[model samples]
Target chain A: MNRLSFLAPVALIGALLLIWQGACSILHTPEYLLPAPTAIVLALILNAPILALSAWRTLAMALEALVAASVFAAVLALLVSLSRTLDRAIRPLAVALQVTPVVAIAPLVVIWAGVDHPDRAIVALAAIVAFFPIFSGAVRGLTSADLDLERLFDLYGARPWQRLLRLRLPSALPFIVEGAKVASGLAIIGAVVAEFVAGSGGAEGLAWRILEAGNRLRTAEMFAAILTLALMAAVVHLCFQALEKRALAWWRGR
Target chain B: MTDVVAALLAVEVDYPGRGKALGPFDLALVSGEIVALVGPSGCGKSTALRLLAGLEGPTRGTVRRAAGRGETSVVFQSPTLAPWLSATANVALPLELAGVAKAEARARAVEALARVGLGAAVNARPAQLSGGMAMRASLARALVTSPRLLLLDEPFAALDEITRRALADDLLAIWREARPAIVFVTHNVEEAVYMAGRVIVMTPGPGRSAGETRVEAPTPRPSGFRTTALFRDAAEAISDRLAAATRAAA
Candidate 1:
């Protein structure tokens, strides 16, 4: 059953690509409009080194931003769980950050961080976009500590720190992993969008490569770059899924 | 008689908006004695257990514990095992919290699990265990600390009849060996009489102790004792008190 489910998507993608290639050839389609999969594949082979470098840069930035967001979210969640006052004070600010689109704020972030540190600005933007899900997940997990377990801890006279470490943190892990799966994808998006606003000059991120290709009317190259970005996002998501399975092995039993 | 392990002196609990939840009553638990609190659903049997465990403060009066905080343990209605942790790790949690070295705590946890007949399942997480096994793991956790006083709130209420009887027998064996003062809360009159030396009946709603019955059944209560006439008589007497208490409350 699992093998059939896995093969189904691969088969569908192959059939769609075959049709796209056939249609493009029979119609004598212009290359600048919608390049055939073959043309995109050719572009990918020709610019393999540069595209690989750009993909790596984008992946690095997204990963860094995700790590920073997770750490910041965890610490914030710990504080929020520690006190009701902190939760009341910080929850609105977090909500505001979440609702505010990263695209709308990216330009301002780049300008504020100054021209010398475009990478920092992009990383910061991605971190902001990725922060809320992890924070909310951690808070929910922490607060959901079992009442019966808490009472047992009370009976044993567990210290506050002990309770936080032994009970609350372990409970929060699956939730944090859940949030991370979502935030990992968002982090890549934030990085790509921020790169778009910042322009392609320094460090030529994948997003910048796409914009450069578009301006030069290198449509096949643009398609190739977009494909690279999609692959990067898929890889990031798959990595997180693997991590979730490992971390929650006790819950999933596999 | 042994010294008093704990006492509730004219204790009553009132929720801010929910009125009186329990008491304006008193009781004492003697060292090495097993006491059961039994009543209808709405009665504050659990509330009384919470007071004894020091999980909640009485609204009106004092609850005094002769045993120190570390000398008390509680088993709640659910097993409450941490899903991520192995049975040994779950059982070792109290010792770990108290700063015992990891190896030492784990060794003690293994010993406790063995006592509950869960020696082979020590590495299993809660999800991997059957209902009876999970409850045994929970019981192991409670006994691991060798507490001077143990508070249990309907610990067997969720189990099948066979599992419940087996666990009750296991609990009796552990109690005999360890001799902790125990306050067991349950709605099962048979269970109350089967496990406890004294059964304290409670009135319904704004609960307080209505009456007490001493079980004359011999110690190390024989296997198949549940079918015996003596056990039935004790259960009947406690049931009568419980029925009267319910009627009086109405």
Candidate 2:
């Protein structure tokens, strides 16, 4: 990005924060109603230990969910690509899982996995939420090889595995990268939503901290937890974006 | 006849919904000969090339092939290089796929790239090369295996005039080495005349052979061959056949 574009968001957010802080002080609004940015920062500092631990847990779960989703999606995508019957058989079920809201299923998952370790349940729910994009992306990538290349492979008498390895998989790499980026964000959202659904189930994640702080009307801490989650999501996105640049260096500048 | 490389004996392809897409057509490739198929769009020139490439089967007739594994290679209209791979790697692919060791394949690939005048761009990705260079890399890949038969389907059509002419000449220069029987397909009448010993004209879709013209000029003609009366007469004969076919279809 250019310098001006990069600075634009920083400038806009700075102005908005100034206005927010000014409005809070001018109106003498209670912290519980809408915590000022300064108050939120202070709360973030004061609860750094608890907040860091919770954030770490949430981030770990999201990462685990992403890896799990990637593996499952890749295997399923390969199976679907291999057989028309398998694709027809599995597609509707995958679509059903995708369309069903994670929030709707989070409670059942938490109860089923046994509330003794709600973290595991949250990760499972998050994986489910993150699964479809990677799966569909993988399926598209596996089949996205150039038609002429397919003909070339056939002419060379490429074995099935050889075709998959040399042509189909490499062709799908960009798609998988994009799908993983989307899945990373969804995985975080899924983790947080699952945490919210499993409130006070002894899960220590940023979402749980938010729920706990809100119960005592510590709105600043709640906002602080949310800010931390937002930061985490942004970092995850930046990581994936960097990865895309590195992994798909050949694909870029085309 | 004993040196016949391959032939389409009354070959026909019928798509499920589209009915006959190609012949009831016949073509035979003799060893070390260059033949071009020229016709209107959708006249099954490409289909004919595909049949020769063994990429498609004839629904109604037999395809006879004497050439065996790695004995045939094709270059399509687009360069169609694997965008993710370096030019050398892309050229090396057919060899590697055919079970040649990676090191040997790569070494030969570099030789092939140099042969096509892309030696400096061996490490460049397909996206990094110019349009003509990419197509040259594709040509190198096709020649890497030294197939007995080379099938080209409108290989230079996407290129500008200068690049097209340069590639056509480069192809001829390379073809002299292996002397593969080449079946070239194109819509460009002059290109068909310039590149092939025989130019076959086809009627419009579900195409049958309209006629064929034999160019008596030698392979890789001298400079200014394009302006020569011999080239003009041969091109005109093919064009006349093409116009007649188009008019008949109309």
Q: What is the TM-score of chain A alone in each candidate?
A: 0.95, 0.96
Q: For each candidate in turn, give its C-alpha RMSD to the true structure in angstroms.
A: 2.2, 1.6
Local distance difference test values of all predictions, in order: 0.90, 0.93
Name the best candidate (by DockQ). 2
Worst window of 10 by summed lDDT in candidate 1 chain A: A245-254
lDDT of 2 at A187: 97
Among the numbered candidates, top lDDT falls to 2
Off by over 4 Å in 2: A1-7, A251-254
Worst 10 residues of 2 chain B by lDDT: B1-10
Question: Which residue pairs does candidate 2 place in steric collision?
Answer: none
Encode model 1's per-residue lDDT on B1-250: one tens digit a residue.
Answer: 5799999999999988888989887989999999999989968788888888888999999999988888898888789998878889999999988889999999999999999999999988888898999989998998998999998889999999999999998899888898999999998999988898899998997998888999877655888888998889889888888888888878
CAPRI tier of model 1: medium
Score residue A219 of candidate 1 by CA lDDT. 99
Q: Which stretches of candidate 1 lie over 4 Å from their true place?
A: A1-4, A250-254, B247-250
